[model samples]
Target chain A: MKLSDMQKDKCVRVKSLGVDAHFLNRITSIGITEGTTIRVVRNDRKMPVLVYVRQTLLALNREDCEKIEIEEVA
Target chain B: MNSIALLGQPNSGKSTVFNALTGARQHVGNWPGKTVEKKEGSFTYKGAKYTITDLPGSYGLTGNSDEEKITVDYIKAGHADLVCILVDASQLERSMYMLAEFAGMNVPSVLVLNMMDVAEDKGISVNAGELSRRLGIPVLPFTAADGKGYDRLRDLFETELSSPHLLTSAPNLAEAKSLKEQGEAKYTWITQMLEGVTTTGSLDYKMSRFDRLATAPVLGKFISIGVILLGFIVAMAICMPFMMLGSMFPVLMNEPIANALTAIHIHPWLVSIFSLLIPNTLYFSTAMAAFVLGVNLVFGYLEEKGFIARTAYQFDGVLSKVGLQGKAVAPILMGFGCTIGGTSGTRVMDNWGQKMLAMAIVWAVPCGSIWAVMPVISGMFFPWWGTLLVCVGILAYVFVLMWFVSLVFGKKLSPVETRTGMIMELPPYHKVHWGHIVKEAFYKAGDIFVRAFRTVIVISVIFWVLQYSASGSLEDSLLYKIGTFIEPVTKIFGLGWQSFMTFLSSAFAKEAVLGVLNAIFVGQSSLLDATFHAKTSGVEGMALAQIMSQTIAPAEALALIFACTFNIPCVMALSTTYRESHSLKWTARVAAFYVGSALLLACIVYHIASLFM
Candidate 1:
């Protein structure tokens, strides 16, 4: 599922980033690479998705968020 | 002196460390041609002199942004004897990505895990010895804010400078074709090196209570407005007392200085320059400096405490629709305080095209000086409700023109693909570091004051010359002759000679609009004399309003208001826009566009209002 579709407080791991090399470098440099655990801190509609990853809080607009593939962390 | 370069991502406390080391011995300048600031400072350690260059912060050495390219180029150019890479100890998992990206650089380096205090507060700890052992380089835990571990930092620097240690545990990725693959390799390398060497103790990965309100979906927008309003109000409060004191300068010293210069048998024009011209300009600069200082202080505090970033994130959705990113709102907010501040504030944007676009839009915002002139001028021409309507009309048109200009200039200035989606870190809230805030606020305020004073003073002298009259008759003055010569053209926009002169002089400084009107309509000898008389009599606003109302029609007043409000903000703002945008063609284009648009708006408003009058 797209990371933007994740509910608040849900933990997930990045499966793949469908973005190009430029954006892929940007996302992964911030520690959002594949297999990194992320918890949705705030995912309200019309707002940027706020996620907690590796002790840092990142806010990504929905368009960027929708390009990230994620898997439920069980 | 031996040289060192400090590198880190934004918010890694690199500046705090630089300031702590250099103290007052820092020199700030641009990096040759780029607007990117180059800060260099020096300190003596163990009887040895060392100079430090604080490289611009970047996410990595990926050469994506100018900042990143500058950092990588500087390192590759071998200007530094040692490279000090700083990472936030509190967020090493993310912050160390810089170090990961730096793996292949073959430069002698030391890793400073700064912000150790914050990490300790969260009950996280790292074994520096083990990490150092694993990475094959020196690592030190540091708290740059509290001045902790500086002695050790110095030792580490000294040791690294003497016998540089390149990374042995990490593979050099210079041969890597794609940055994505290099980033993946680096992260994998970072993960292996950090294994068993760090502990994140029960880290609570959640937004704080205040942050919840700050980022809440629809509600966050309202909260951001309240917060921004509150911040602006506080800035105004802090500035009012200083501005009031500044206003007293012209009243207190005008007569005495005029008498002294005249008594000294000085030329009347020379006397005017000293008595009337100097104090008036001083008063203006004082008000500008105090208010800009307040803006820097309050907004600096907001930015430091991390609230400003939240506002950017909250507003991204709305602002993006207007062909700007969330970060563009910062410059817009500063535009309400001062256009120079707003123009300079565009430095925060990473994209140069976006920076230029933001500067162009800042010109459309009714600046502080316009706000000061508009309400009183509007009140003179219309009733209370009508005055309020004009004020609201100006604001409504401000947004309309903003969208209109963005539509016209958006594609050429900022390409669609460059609207790179927002991917930013929302730093944790912390106490305001007063030392850093005050130092920065004063530096920015002082820089702007000097530039603004230069522009204001030069223009005031020219205005004095134009307003000079040996016969003391308005028509005999050069300003009147020239103004009337152009009156035929200006009247097309509903402005008489006096109003045309007012509109022209306003390009130098908006407050000068009133002085022009007073000089011509209120029977003052010159612009300088009018400013002095108005200051001493303390009835400038009320008196000028009454005089102008009788002489100028309500329709013309409405036209003048619209024209002046949208004119190029000031010469200072023009120069600042040029300096910030680094594009002479764009600056001239924007200036000419504003002038044309201002006249067009006036012509339109005047004709429409004339039908009713």
Candidate 2:
């Protein structure tokens, strides 16, 4: 499943990023590489995920989430 | 000797490291093609000298921005033997991405994980040895603020110098391939490495209740306006007492000094130069300088304490309702005190379009200098309501200017979403540092004093010579001829030759307008001393009043307002603009725009009021 498909407040390890090559590179460069655990901190009304990556928190739009490949760890 | 380049995003504590190594010997210069500062320093570590260049903080080495371009170019060109990538430990993921980019550069580098304390506080743990093994480089965890890991960093640098090996990694390739699929690879390769080590866990982050309410559209707007107005009220409450105190000090000092000079039987010219010119210039400049600096320091303190950012965020919510946002709020808030000061602050805004728009409309807001002068303009000629109306008129003009710029430029009016939600980390609240404030006040005052002593004093002397040489009786000199040339223009404003000369001098410095008036009437007496006595006498020591009473009707106060508002900016503002924009063309444009608009508006306002009055 894509990381965005995970339920809100659920922690899951990232399996693979299925996004377009450019964005995947960018996100990975930002330390969002696969095999890392990510927890959904909040979800907007539109279900866009806001996640904490390391020490910094980020809000990713739903459209951007369609490309993130992940597995349900919890 | 090996050279190391320290690179990281801003606020990463690089300066602390630079200070620790070089002490006070760092040389700071503006980076080529960019206004962001470049800091370079050298120090001996382990008996080998190492020179380090601290590049401006950047998120990545992509050549998208000027700062990024410089960092990338310097590294790619082999300018340094090793690059020390300083990553904030607390913000490891974000820092890691940049580190990955550096790794892709295939350059020898040592990764220094700074801010370790903050990371530890947040319950985040990084196995530095494991991370180092994975990235194939030495990883040193440091807390630059407290001077931890300096020796380790030095040792790592020395070890890297002994055997310089480039790490080969396409760690970002999979993520790159996943994201874009085409693998255009505009960015360097280390972005791949970042993908392997970073992970996030589900956590619920909620906006504070206060933040939510403050950003609520309607309430936010009301609160924003109130906050801004309150800022103005607070500034005035603080400034007025200081202004009065400043006015009193000169009066007290000048009278005694003037009397002492007279008792000594000093030559009249020497007495005039010493007692009147020097003292008045010094007092007025010092007072105004102190006033401006005091207000700025208060704002700075509030900003340092995080109150301003909180207020700005609340205001941002209000602006969002009106389709405005970002750093534009700072300039507008600054406008409440002084349009010129607001214009000077435009450089701090990161958004280019916002900077230009803010600069264009800043002058439409009346500053304290104009505010203080307005009462003098209206009381002698027009009613008090006229002064209020002038302020309102300027506000309307600014609104119209803002609208025009937005429309013409097709600039998008929307709330700016900051990459980081927090404006600035608020320093721990504490008692106001009076020592720092006083030091800053003196620093600012001294800078202005030096400028005045050098430029304004010379101008005063030259003007003095011109007026003395052109006419034996101060009536028929080149000063008068120049005033005559502008007299027809001044007549519309109820001003004669003297007022015209004063208005022209205003271009040099707004206070110089008062200075010229003093030079003409006080005739070598200290201008501040004259102003003090004039205020006591209720004439306010403004020479324009005497000229107004002699030559024109009271209705021409509108003309004087126009002249005052629209005249060229002071020398400090012009120099500031040049420094901020780093373009002579823009500076000239700003000056020309103010001068032209002032002339045109003054003409229209005078003509319209002339018919009715």
Best by DockQ: 1
In model 1, the clashing pairs are: none
Highest TM-score: give the candidate number.
1
lDDT per residue as tens, model 2, A15-60: 6676444455446544466666677655544423556654455545
Model 2: CA > 4 A from native: A1-74, B1-4, B10-57, B138-170, B174-199, B206-325, B338-348, B351-364, B402-478, B488-499, B505-550, B553-555, B568-589, B608-613
Interface RMSD for candidates 1 onward, in order: 2.1, 7.2
> Distance (Å) between predicted and true CA of B467, model 2?
5.8
Report the Cα lDDT for residue B238, model 2: 59
lDDT per residue, candidate 1, B1-613, as tens digits?
A: 4899999988887877888888768876657766466789999999999999999877877756667888888999999889899998888878989998787787888999987777777767889999998888899888776644688888888888888898777745666566656766777777677777776322258567888888887777788777776776787798789889988888888899999989989988788788877887777777777767777787777776778788889888777776777867877887887786677667556456677888989889988778887787787778889988898999999998898778878877666665677888998886565776677667766766676677678877887788777888887889888988989999999998878787886677676677667766777446656543433233376777888888788899999999999999987788677656656777898999889889999999999999998
Residue lDDT tens for model 2, B97-141 = 566557568788878888777667655676777677767778888
Candidate 1, residues A1-74, lDDT tens digits: the string is: 99999998888888888748778877887878777778888888867899988788899888889899999976
Q: What shift in Å separates residue B323 of candidate 1 from its native position after superposition?
A: 4.4
